[model samples]
Structure formats: structure tokens, C-alpha cells
Target: MATAYRQTHDHPKEYFVETDTDTEDSDFDDFVCSDSGKSLDATIFADLEQLFQSQGSEKNDQPGKLLCEVQTEENIAEIFAEIRKEYKPTEAEWRVSNIDERKDHEAASLLDDAFESVSSEVEKSGSIEGCSSCAESVNVLDVSQFKKGQHISMPGKFGTIYQHHAIVCDVKSTSGTKAELELIHFENKDKSIRIRKGIKTYDLKNKQIYLKHYKKQRYDCQLIVSRAETILEDFKMSKFKKYNFLLLNCEHFATWCVNGEEECFQVQGALQMMVDTLTSALGIGSRVVKVVQQLVIMSTDEIAKTISSAIVPEIVLGATAGVYLLYCLAKTAYLKMAYKKNNLCLTCLKITLKEMWLGFLVFSSTSVVQLLIYTFAVPAIGSGVGIPLVVLSVLLSVALKMSVNTFLRVLRNPFGKEKTKLSRPSQLSIADIVAFSYYRLEHVAIVTDILDVNERAQTARVRCIHYGLPKLLAKRQIVEEEFEMNLVNSSWHKFDVDDTTSYACEKRLSRARERVGEKRWSKTNRSDNFCHWAVVPIARWDNYAFEEVNDKEKKNKSVEPFFNKYPGYIAEELRLGDVVDYKETGVLVRKQSKVDQGKNVVEIDLIITSFWKGERKTYTIDLKRDDIHVMYYKPALCISMQDRVERALYWEGRRNRLLWTTNGFIESCILKEEYLDN
Candidate 1:
């Protein structure tokens, strides 16, 4: 048997030689015999001898064995050529061996000089030139430079091109040329349904490496180091999961490694695209279904056959034209409803038209491409499959076009003008008596203050007193008993005031009125079945009633002059039946009654006459009082009193006695003729 000896070196070589062990030989003779092992047999030794000889001048010998020389480039090339002809290796295997060697050698040469220069500069400056951390230098390309706890990035190819990141846990190098890295990375698969920690080993030459620098300070370095070993162990015991490209991808993992936050910009962008696509698809789907339904309902047997026999180009053109017409009709109907709902002005209508035009332009362009696909490509594939395919293409085309239009709409202004102003028939102000006109409650109220105004809705919030027993509580015996008065005699009451509550109450009242066969109430007009409160500026009456004149001669005038100078005179101390009438002077007053007495009332300034519940009535009021109370008496009950008061006012020619009308009330107590002349 021949003995084989292998030389121990950085690059090892094997040699075989035959020796006679039966004959004893001296050490020097054995060495000489080993030297001549290359010349033993020409055929068997030719290739092996050449391989050893080309290795270099270095030699090693063992007793009764041949010595082998170091390998060199020329001999290795010859051996590689011979091996290539006889035994062919697969591309993967060839890359694993030969390609890896070449890559490692090239990488080492390129990075060695750069690393040395960076190191010298860092040593002098105490930091890398552009990087705060020496380990995160931008020049890092060789995997040999990867240290434990360092974040590294790898460029991805094929399905994922977003680049992946990992943390280096371990690094090993052979002969300072080839490097191996063990890395740990976090990955989420199946749209974040499964989370996985993974560990992988990679040859330096097979992957491109970069030192990943954090944009912000990384404070979790120690935590990363502590968890790395546990993560790697867990990864080795776990099964692989499917990967998602958008929701849970490689970019998400890399960001997590660097900053402990899981985020991916690519995933965010893709999700937004999906949302827009879905919105467009839903819109198109609804329209397409409606169109198909209409077509099915209207189609005749003859029409179906005619459609089937039509050429592909003609069919495509007709379909495109039909879709555009459908869109135009839909848009016109939508615009009509919107115009009625919003009552848009001419400027707003123009703006809406421009927006529609932009959408139409985008749709036209997409339809052209869809027409081509349907005419040329889809027809060749047979109508059975092509019909559904064409429908799907139309859906996608509409979706894409609408998405672009929506994106552009958001980027620019969709509404090019300010909102249109509302036309309101009523004006809200302080101290205006406003009834809940349409609710049929017949509840009289006095406006204390206007709380809020919604100009867009043409509504206002006026704080008021409901004045009588609420319609809800009118039939309840407890309400009458608690106040010790009839439902009609109840004093001021408070009610909640807001748009929603008022609207709900109005709706309920409408249903009740409809069931009762009552006429529908109008907001603009007053009805005998309903009490419509008028806006009365009673402050203007108070100002006109008590006008004080600064006269030099009458500086100290007192109560005695009122009997001589004016027609009306009534005192708080006087009885109700006292003889005091001033009809000729166009001024009339009455004694201050007990009902006008309150802590808020300092004095009764004036008695203003106004129509209440379709009857004329006099109310004693103080200018300082914040709220006034009025009662709603039915027309039948107050008809006699109203007729008497109307006859008296007419005979006295007090036609402008601060009378209140349905829409609004006159503030001045002066007669209409005198007021208009002034």
C-alpha cells in the first residue's frame, strides 16, 4: 500500500509515494527517496508532479513518503482546466467554490486599503470623517469589518428590492481574505399575523454589505446585545413562515433593528395605493352593476344577436361612447341634486364643472388604452373568456383613472370658491320674542338673548322662556298641582334650545299634525292653529317712552308737571279704577299691577301694546328686566277683550302703538302717520 502525506500550510497540498518498509534506510536516504517520488511513474505521477512543482519552492518530507511543494497560480490554473473538461460542476456549485474565491480576493484587496486609510484618519480625529461612530463608517463593504451589535444592511433582489437590515452577532474570517457573518433579523409574515426572529449565515463575497447608521442616537445597544443570543436560539427552533411584500416586509425589519421601531415607508405607500384603488373599484363596481342591470332589462333577442355579431373595434368604440354618455347623465343628475341641496351660486357651479372636466379628461385617456386592449388583444382570446376579461379591464381602467383624478383633486383645490351664503327670512337678536312656530305647541315665548348663530344652516339659537305649561306636561295633573294654577296660567318656563333637539321636536310635531289631519305649518307665515312669535325690539319702545329733555328752565321739574304737560298719568300707588284717561293727547297708561312686581323690577317704565295670540294686549314692562313673560290665550277666550281693545285704540287713533306683526314688530309708540313723516 502507498502511504499518503498531506502538507500542513495555509493552502494545503497532498502527495503520494511508494516506499519499501522491509529494508531499513537511513533518515538522509529516506529524504532522498521522498525527493525522487515525483519521477517514479510517468503516467500516474505526471499530473501530480506538475501540480506539486507549480506550487512553489517550499517542500516538506516524511519518512518513506514523498514531499509536496506549495501551490502557485500557474499550476492551479492547469489543474482547474483539466478538471473542467472531465467533470462538469453545476452553476450553483461552481459559484460556491470558484466564484466565491475570486469575489473574496477582489473584495479584500479593494477594502483593505480603504479601511486602513479610514482607520488612520479616525485615530487622528477621534472619529470617522462623516460618521460619528467609527463602526458605522460609510466605507464599510467587507464583511470582515462587521462587529457584534453593529447594524448592517443588505440590498435585496428579485421579489424584494426594498433592502433588508440585520444586526451582526458574530463574524469569522479565513486567511484575512474570505469572511463569514452570522446575523440576526426580525421579520413579520402574513400581513403581521406571524412574527419571527431569524438567524442566517452568509459568505461575505456572496452579499453586498453596508454599515447602517442611525439617523438618531441609538440608546438600545445593550438591549440589542442581550437579546441577540436568545433570539438566535429561538429562530433556530422555529419553523419558517410565508413573507408578505407590503404589510410586513424586509424594510420593516431593518428599521426595527436600528431604532426599535417597526416602520416601512414602502409598506405605507403601498397601503395608501391599495386604499385608493379599493375606493375607485367600489365606485366603478356600483356604476357597472347599474349599467348591466339596465342593459339586461332593455335588451331584446334581436339586439343580443346584433351585439354578438358586431366587429371587435366597433364594439369597443360603441362601449366607450356608451360609458361616456352614462357618466355624463349620472354626473348631470348628481349636479342637479347637489345644486338643489346646497343652493350653490354661479361661481360654485362653475368650479364644480371644471372639476368634472378634469375627471373626464383622465377618464378619456384611460378609455383609449382600454379600447385598444379590448379591440386587439382580448378578441383573439375568444369571447367566452374575453367577455369577462374585458369587463375586468374596464373596471381596472376606471379604477386607475379615478385614482389619478382623486390624487390630483387632493393635491389641488377641489372647491375653488368660498361656501355660498344662506338666505334666511328671520334675523335673530337680543330681546326678540320668537315662538317655536312650526311645532303646533302654541307655546308663547320671549327671547332673552341670541346664544349662537349658524349662518350656513340659516338657524339661530335664542334663549327664551316657554311662558306656559309645556305641551308635553299640559295633560299631566302634577304640572298644574305643583304650580297651584291651571295649565293656561303657568308662569315662565325654560326649554332646551339647539338645532338637533328643535329639529327632532319639529319632526315629531309634524307626524302628530299629519295624523290629526291639520294643515302643515309654514315657517314664513302665521296660522291661527299655530302661534308665530314676532321679533320685537322692546328696548326701542323703552327709549322712546321715557325720553328726558335737558331744559334750563325746567331743571327741577317734578311729578306735578306730568299732569300739565302730557296726556297719560298713572302711579304705582293708584287704584285700578281710578279716573285717569288721556286719549286726546294720544297717551294712555294704567296703574302698576301686582303681577309686574318682582325683585328684578325696579320700576314699571312703560306699557307696550302688541298683538299676542291674534289679540291685542297691554303688557307692563321694566326696561331693566332681562326676560318678559307672555301667556298664550286661545282666540275664542280672548275675542271679546281683543274687540274692545281694538275699538278703543281705533277711536283714539293709536294705530302705531308698538304693535307686533307675524314677521317683526314696530318698536316706536308713535302713530304710523307721524313716524313715517319724520
Candidate 2:
């Protein structure tokens, strides 16, 4: 009967191989007869001949030949259709497993009725399972007893192998088993992670098959299994890799009596095979199909933030290991050069060991992290284990311990010891130079890595830095604002004269006050709008040192304008009568004056020819020695100066030396009152 069935139905050559044993064939025949010769079909017979013909070819093609034209979707559908038509369900006995015995017995009666109905359908003419077979006994396994295994496939991105799995403990849902098995095959075909090795099956009590998977990491495994449902749905809809988005997969139990090999038996193909079959079924252009494949392969499920948070540290550490290689190279060079004399110097040895140790930590941590992620975190957490909780628990233990140990010494002494120590610069030995260069390169790479992670802002900053002068010059307001009032004031010097003091006394007293202020401000008074001055925040400069201002040492002095007492002004010409005429004018006005707390201060107003008259007239003025050579500056200077003065605003606010400057100017020109506004 087996031989005849093989001849009659185009079962694959491999399926027929078992039939070669005549004794077994007879047994199978008896089973079939008792089941009403349901397996016999004229169409299957024709396909069997084709399988036989193909089998005569190369040994290697045996599987393919067995699969030959008989492997087609149409043929399998027809075969299943025939089987459904012939095998009336009522004729056979069926039972449910993993359920209470009493309930099972009750359910068995329902199952018997269902089988009887299907048996009647088989006795009739048409194919498709009868309504009775589809009804009451839809599922044979009682799912309550089973623990589901994980989904086997992962949405992948960045060339990493993503995989997942779960355990099946309840009476296994046959359909769910097919899904799991299909995923195992899918992983087997994934070339990215060297998963070419075929599945290894474990022989259980029944003829059930299981696959042992090698996962790159726990997280990858978890991610895959969690999204199994989405993946299978995607397969069904022919939208496996529709977009460059996260792939979602999930798992659930359902009935499965249909044979996996049957084409109409839709659910049991791996992602890769799905792609292949889809391409074949659609008969679309290869290019279009290829595009689809790329999308599916790249589709990845978004890991939960909690999972990602747990996962990122491993990635970071891995990246850090890459960075530490640069450090190692630097250290190697140092050992070869400067430390060559005492190759075994304890300090050098310690440094070498320290660096190597750090490198190992980085690498080992990364690898282990990836492993844990794929093996446990992803799968276990994804299976409702609460990933965040698990991650936190793990981090508080290992990460915390490592961090403390690594940072202990550095935290202990951030600065030098009490004793002063002179440091010798390591001459630019070849090793030193190499180490420095390596360090710089690695540092740049690290910076770039960070920037890549924060693409938008960093990219803009890089562009700005690239343009250099344009950004600086175009930002006039910014440049102007950057001016340090203190720096300008420190660079400029001026003398103040009092009514009771002579020139020599004023100069002497001014110098004395400047010296006194120097101790407080720790800076010199310079000119306003000095182009040479750079308004750099000491902290930002990397080269500046911080100093605290001494308030008690602040000088008590007042600035007396040199032009106050004998303020002189030049003449300007006016064309009031159609003729240019000379007029002696006092353009400078005493806008206001005030003295507060023994500090003398004065405000003078001036109308520059350019300000009051655009290049029409000019003024040349001199000041008396006692009046002082005080200069009236713009408000910007005063504002900036006040800001610095409030807190000795140095780069680090070291001293009470806050001064600033402004370029806007007003001339001390003289004009006749006749030309002035009434």
C-alpha cells in the first residue's frame, strides 16, 4: 500500500524512503485501509511518478526531486483537499491531552461527534473539511498545561543577528509549534550571524521536533521572541519587511491537524523562505523582491527603553574598548622608549597593567553584555519578566561595584599633596609623541562618536566651527558682547587730579592708588576698545588661572576730570549767512555731577561734530592738569563694567578688577551758542 500510495501520490522521495521497508509499508497500508483508504488520490499518483523520475537523478538533488513538481502549492492543496474529502471524522476516535480526566471524558464525546460528522463528509464526494470537522474538535491540545516557547525570529538592523525563543510547557499547540519551528529555520538561514548550521532536534516522547539555537546575546533572543506574533502576521499578509521600522513578533496557541508540507497549510515557513516563496508566488521582478527582502531583513523591533537602557551600557563599554586600544598603543610606545631603561620599573609596570586591565574590562563587559542581552534580558523580560526591574537589580550589583573600584583613587586626591612637587616634562620622546598622537586621535574619535549619537546639534556645531571667521564676524552682537570690561580696564592707565593737588602729587597719588588697587584687582587699567584685548572667560581659555579678589585691599580714590576746571574747546564754522564764519563754542556741557561716599564722579555731555553735525565742523581741546584727563565713555562700557565690578568678574572672578569698553564716541567739540537749539 505504501509503494502504491507513493506511486499514486507524489510524496517527496525522502518521505517515500521510509516506505522502502516492505514490512512498514504493509503496516501503513493497514492503517490507511482502516481509515477508509483516505490517502489514495489519482492526482497524487501522477505527481508520485514525477517525484520518482526526479529521484533517479543526482544523489544531491534527491531532496529537491522528492520535493520536485510535487512540492508545488497547487498540488499540496489538492492532496489535502482529497484527504479531507475521504477521511470522515466520525469514523476515527480523537482525544484531548493535558486536561482534567473528567472534563477530558466529557470533551471526548464532543470530539467523537465531530469525528463522526467529518467521517460522513469523507463518505460524500466533495473536498474541503466538512463543517463538523471544523467545529467542535477544532483544537486537540488543552493549552492550559503548556508553557509557550519564545518566537524564534527578530527584526534585524545594523547587521546584528536578532533571535528569540520561549519554552512550551502546556500540552503544545501544534500550530504554535509550527510557528516556532519555522522561526528556527529562519534563523538557520540568516547568514549575518553565521546561522547556516541547520537545526538540531531533540527527540521527545512523541514525534515532536525542537531546535537548539545559538544566540549572540540574551537581548537579541528576547527581542525576537517577544515580537513573534507580528512577524507571523507579517508573513501571512506578504508584508514581511514593509517598512524600515521595528518588527513585532508574538506567539499564541491554536489547533494544527494540517500537514506542514502542504502548500495550503499556510503557516509553517521561515522568514527567508517566506521571502523566497513570496517572490515565487507573486512572480514579481527580482529587483522588486530584493528590495522587499532588504526591508524585512532590516526591520527591527524597537527595544523597550528599559531594555535599551540596560543594553546601551554594554554597547558603550564595547565602544570604550575600541577607544582603549588607542591607549594601549600609546602605552606600548611609552614602554618601548622612555621606560626602556628600567623596563621593569614599578611605576611603568603599574601604568601598563592599569591600562591593560581597563581595556579588558571594556571588552569583556561588552561581550558579556551582548550575551546576557540575547540570552536572558530580551527573552525573559520580553516574556513579561519586567526588564527594568531585572536590569536595575543587576546594575546595582555589578556596575556599581566596578564604578566604585575604578574611581576610588581619583576621588581620593583630586589635586596635589600638601608638599610642593616640581614636575618634569617628559621630553617629546618618540614614544611620548606617539602616545600623545594616539590619545588625541582616540579623543577625537570619542568626540565624534558622542556627536553622532546627538546628530542634529552636533552637526550644526561642526558646521559653525568649520566656517570659522564668517560665524565670528557675522555675529557682531555676540562678538561685542563677549568683550571683557576688566581686561580692557586692566590694560589702560589714567591719572586723576584734585583741586588741592599739584600735577606731581596727582600722578604720585594715582600711581599709589593703582598699586593699591592692583593688590585687590590683580590687574592693570588699560584703554577702552583696545583691539588687542581678548575677552576670554578664564575657565574657557584652558590656560587661565583663577584668583580671588581681595576686598579689604581695594583703593579709595576718586577720578577728577582733567578738563573740568579749565575746560577748553575749539571753534567751528557756521554758514548761517551763506558764508562760512568762525564761531567759538563750548560744545562740551556739564550734564551732571555727583560725589558719593568720598568718591568723586562727574558726567559731562558732548556733541561731536559727527554726532551733532556730520563731518561739518571739528574740535581740538586740552585739559588742565588739576581737572584730570578723564574720558567720557559710552553706556555699554559702563554696563559691562558694572557687571564685572559687582563680583570682580574675571574668567574666574579672581579680583576686584572689572572693567570693559565700548567703541561709540562723542567728541569734545566747541560751537557757538547761536548755532545751538533755542
Best by lDDT: 1
Instruction: TM-score each candidate.
Output: 0.21, 0.15
Span of ten consecutive residues with least summed lDDT in model 2: 442-451
Model 2, range 1-678, lDDT digits (tens) per residue? 234433423323332122222252132221122233222222233333444344435332222222221223443343333323333212221111112334323333332332333333432422222111111111111112122333222223322243232222222233311221223212323332211113232211111222222111111333233333323333333222232112322211111111111111112225324433332223222222332332332343453332333434334444544555555576467544422222123332444456455534544454455445445554544523434544454444345434643553332211111111112222111100001111122100000001121222211111000001124334211011111112111221111112231223333223222211111110121111111011111011111112222334221112111111111111111111111111322223323334434223333432222222312223222111112222322111112222322211112212111111111111111111121122
Candidate 1's C-alpha runs over 4 A off are 1-150, 153-165, 170-179, 186-205, 208-213, 220-223, 227-257, 263-277, 291-678
List lDDT for all candidates, in order: 0.36, 0.25
| lDDT score, candidate 1, position 219 | 28
Report how far off residue 575 is in candidate 1 (Å): 99
